[model samples]
Target: MVHTFSGNPLDREDAGRRDDVWIDTARDDDSTRFLALADLNVPIEGESLHWLHREHFDESDLESALLLGSEEGAARFVVDLSNESASADRYVDARSAATFLSMEDAGVVAHARSLVDWHRRNRFCGRCASPLIPKRGGNVLQCGQCEANLFPRTDPVAIMVIVDGDRCLLGQSSGRMARSNFYSALAGFIDQGESIEEAVRREVMEEGGVRVGDVRYHSSQPWPFPSSLMIGCHGLAETTEISIDEKEMNDVRWFSREEVLAALAEESDVLRIPGRMAIAHHLIHDWATGTIEV
Candidate 1:
């Protein structure tokens, strides 16, 4: 199941190092290797930043390079001189790159991108009005004043595929692209003091106006668009009637397994389900394949 999606597994041996690692974005040295995310259709160049593993290369083995960030608050990742043979001139967005890279490679890149984005956004200390510095090999942020340490945060979100018998509940968000009738599971952020089960029930009720029972955790994924951990679940539908919150969703409906498979295979730009890169797609696929029983 994990291997079905992109950015699932990463070789963490090098990233597990406890030393403060550097990401070089400069072009002068030719010894470093760079993975071009833009080639895969990610909209921004180096917009996502998070480190997965660190490799110990001698300072002399690699040349010092500058990290470049976008004017709109993008961080500069490591520069690779070894990628000189590759076309560095081309810039592919991260979204497209996720499709291009092998699932393992995409996962690594997503981790690094998420970490870097965290560092950039959390530049100031929350406890004190002091500037924070990177520590713990870029994993921890320390405030110069008061000596406070901060860690990266992954927001927990609950996403569920609600099932009754031969049908599952799906909703279309109001913010969806034009001409899109595609729907997946209902999802929402988990509020504080709410258990995952509670979240599943609450989100289902709030978004689709349906009561859910027997909520069970199915799988989880690190969604690093801006640091989110998607908690996937399967919820037994206690009520089939759906009353969607018009402000949040455009429409809600129940889909049969056959209908879902059709949507999954649908290639039209208009009638498409979530991409395979997303856990939503996995949840649907799993349900369709009987891997996740309601």
Candidate 2:
């Protein structure tokens, strides 16, 4: 149950796979809408979310564009205006942009950001170091020098809620923007060929020296910081003592349910977890409500 962009109901028809009339018709049709991005900054109109129509800009202004999908007989596209800095009315962080947008709007913006970032980073073929062209309606890149089609990739990460008796393990990463000691669930990227469950167990063991006994799958979230699929889970820990990985986290400790509940019920100076927008927050919320235990 990825909360962000995954639940999209739109039909993302592959431009390479089908010969649908709508695909061609969408390009010229007035219903075709465009979400413009300039250096990863999404355009926000007033209060409600809005996208630019093809009428809004000259064709030359579009540095790159991708066919996102279609909904309700209309096609939606995302264009990177990173080459055109003058188009932005006011620049805003794309991550913060998704925070208050409507579900449908947020979903599209998230997809747009992910695709644009993929395209931006992969301008050249890894094999030949030659320029790559957009293919499959911008879902993939192809090298003209060689017949290779490179596709967008999403990294898989495991985020866990680990419990030992009445206490839960949470950590504050040194990589965080602030050192206010706001803690969240332990997370790590899944190694190649590793299952989500294995990743959860290994990450917990490595980061906090907590041997996980039971691992249960929870809901997931699409964290589109670049692109990552967060697999959420609940873990029962066999060991209570923590051995902090100083390199990975600034602080690691076990907090009782009472302590977490207090923070969840109200804002506090001592601790803060991620907000409602993150799956980590939901994982902590569920634990606070006695939804899961060791």
Candidate 3:
């Protein structure tokens, strides 16, 4: 199934992008399409990206445009319009845009946002504090002084629904969801030298004080909120004790299959989980409805 940002239809010509000649030609080509982002907000019209031509942007602006991929032999690029003032209504944040965009369009936007944001944040070398230059169609960032090659990094986060008999473990973080009933799958970044199962067990134990014995892979989603690959999983709980880490979570509890079903159907005021846009929703729905055996 094509999740929100999972099915990007771009042909990221890996070998072709490495050649400067082809990259330069594509940048100036009249047929090349560009998607603009102002402060990471996508420009949209009638639920579609407002694509611009090469002529619309200055030569300097085109130099920094990231090569998203190729479509029908035409290069698709994304450029940041943060310096240029635009109408607020014409643009929407990537998260909100995903709600209305097609799977392919949302994938493109996610790709653009993650790559552009990476470039914006890593303008300088981490080792030498020197300026970094974009290379290989903006895929690689080479430092001028230190000559360090940096690539875009995607953080792996383990999100799982821990099962305990007829109940599943879910939590609300200490921010926006703290005041609401919205609870999602327990998640945390996979450590530098940790496996997906290890991360799932660690996160569940840390957040909800639950001991997980068996872990099974569910699915993965490209969550581009500053570039994160959410590794979804299902875990079998060995213990059913609740101990909330007050700093990280507002509340963590086990919800029954009946209650979860009610919430998923929007008939329960006591609990609410994420919609189809999130991998957590699928994880919860599948378990509650017996779509998967954990």
Candidate 4:
């Protein structure tokens, strides 16, 4: 199943965006629409996104706006209004905004947020510490002195639920989840030269102190808190001993099918899990509900 931030419908004009003339024309086009984001927050009106026109911004603003994509032959771009004094009420945090936004809109906003944030953070070249200029409609950052090109990157994270018989392993991380009393599937970033299956097994062992075997891929989600691709999986546990990593986790334990079901339904006071917005929810729900067996 495609997750919340995975179904962007806009046509990311890859070839056309490479041309400087085409980008200028599109930015000047009357039909072009720009999504204005302030402090990485998205603008919302009622139940939908509040898109602004090109005329609302000056030439300097339009110059830095990143071309997101096109819909129905009209150009679409995203501009960061972090420096401007925008009304706070009209904007909502991207994480909270996704709950009310349409799946397609959420995907577009995810793309915009990640792209704009990357540009904001990568203004200088890493190789030579020179200023990097935007190219290919802000998709590529080119270093002027070194003549090197850099592109935005999405980090991969492995999130999995390890199962043994009728019970599944879940963990509460050290800080936020510990305070809120929420448990989620153990997750960690994929390391360099590490395969997804290897990462899953390693992470399970490290965080939950349970050895995992026979990993299976389930689904993936685009997490745009500065851009991450969450790879979800299900695994069979070879051991059930709990020795939670004190530095990383507050608690890690195995819960029965009944416990997880009640938690998914929001009927359990002792256990709480993330909502549908997270892929971890699907991983746990699918396994506990017998939708997928490990």
Candidate 5:
């Protein structure tokens, strides 16, 4: 299955990056659909997520807008709201919006969230401390003094299902909130100069004292909570002695296949994995159902 934000709904035309006139024209076009965000809060209406039409909202209410590209002859653009008090438009974070919106809309909204969030954080250049200006339709930021270019960033995370025979290892991160006996897959950010497979092996050993061998790539998901690319994989555990790092996880344990099945079926008294909204859920489910090669 295509993960929530893995599939994009718009065609991010690369060739149009140099067309300043086209970008400006598309932003003001009547067929343009705008997604306005403020402090990472997205606009919503009733049960549906709607985008602002170009002619509806005042131009003054927009802070920084980007050309998102066309679909079926209609242009889609994402904009940052000038202020919180500008309009009474209902707003919610990406998590809440994902629950009610379709996968395509969720993906589009996530893209918008990452873009607006990048612009909000990268207001100045690190080289010369000069204010960065939006270029290439907010896809790139340029420094006036140094002429340095900045692009949106995405952190890559290795989220894996470590299987040891009939059971799989799962843990709750030390930073995660209390989840009433819930344990998801172990994940860590990919380190510099390390391949994703190497990062997975290293993290498993560092966290739980387990040796991972034979890693298999499964799927990837775009986790838009501040922009993350989740690389989901399955790993066979060569040794499974439980010696967990307290600083890495609040709890770490092994659950049997039957236990995982019960949890996925919502009939477990011990384990409660993440819901379908997360890639971890899919990873766990695939392992539990014998779909993933161990």
Candidate 6:
């Protein structure tokens, strides 16, 4: 099972409900289609949703619709169904119920938030100061003057669950352990001109000072805090000498399968890991349950 952070209990029936509803940019005459800022369920009233763009709604019929940018400067589109408006109680606001929705819903919200933010920030061209226009149903931006086309970016990052038989590798960020026991697999950004495999090898070697071989891809998730795509993997540890980068991690060690099970069952006090909302949890869980074949 994939561990997802936000949107755990989303009502599947409510998501993408108004595929036929017309969404459009806010018009001067459209008094009801104003924007509101999303803030963890508490919306800021009278806030104008920036980065107005159009999207095609095709349920029973095809229609054009307007998508709104969230207050956090993330792109999100809501269908305007005032003509056939459903109960306000029916729609689950992303702000309030992010933590309660399913992993899929969380992923959708994260994508929307990040894309909207990208649209807002890249309003002007980098080459010359000129206005940019939306393209590809808000998936890309094109400059009017310089003609620079910018696509939606998903930053690639590598996170691996290194295993040595019954024990798994885990690390903690320095200074944050006191606030909460945050333990996760070795992770780092994929550098330019490097393959994913190369990045994985380089990151594990640099962070944990361990040599990994037979690296295998596990799974991936969209982490849209600011647009990151986390690539999860499993690696075989050839050597296990803990030499952590003091700037990146405080400590790195191997946790036995039993120890991880204890943590999952809330039976261990010495170590605590991320909740089921994180990919790290899935990576560890897969190993603990004998699902990770490596």
**Of models 3 and 5, which has the larger lDDT?**
3
What's the lDDT for all of these models?
0.65, 0.79, 0.92, 0.92, 0.84, 0.62
lDDT agreement of model 4 with the native:
0.92
For model 1, the stretches where C-alpha displacement exceeds 4 angstroms are 3-87, 267-271
Model 5 TM-score, 2 decimals: 0.95
lDDT of 6 by residue, 233-258 (tens): 88898998878887877888889899
Give the true-structure RMSD of model 2: 2.2
Residue 271 lDDT in candidate 4: 85
lDDT of 4 by residue, 112-139 (tens): 9999999989989899999999999999
Question: In model 6, what lDDT does residue 201 have?
Answer: 84
Clashes of each: 33, 0, 0, 0, 0, 17
Q: Estimate each model's TM-score.
A: 0.75, 0.92, 0.97, 0.97, 0.95, 0.72
Clashes of 5: 0
- lDDT string, candidate 5, 81-200, tens digits: 746453435788888888887787888888888888888889899999999998887789999999999988999999998999999999987875544688999999999999999999
- Give lDDT for model 5: 0.84
Name the candidate, 2 or 6, with the larger TM-score value.
2
The lowest-lDDT stretch of 10 consecutive residues in candidate 4 is 85-94
Query: Where does candidate 5 clash, by residue pair?
Result: none
lDDT of 3 by residue, 1-294 (tens): 457898999999898789999998998888899998999999998888888888788887798888988999999999988898753359999999999998999999989999999998998999999999999999999999989999998999999999999999999999876968889999999998999999999999899898999999989999999999999999999999899998999999889999999999999999999999999999999999999998
Winner on lDDT (1 vs 3): 3
lDDT of 5 at 104: 79
Q: What does candidate 3 score on TM?
A: 0.97
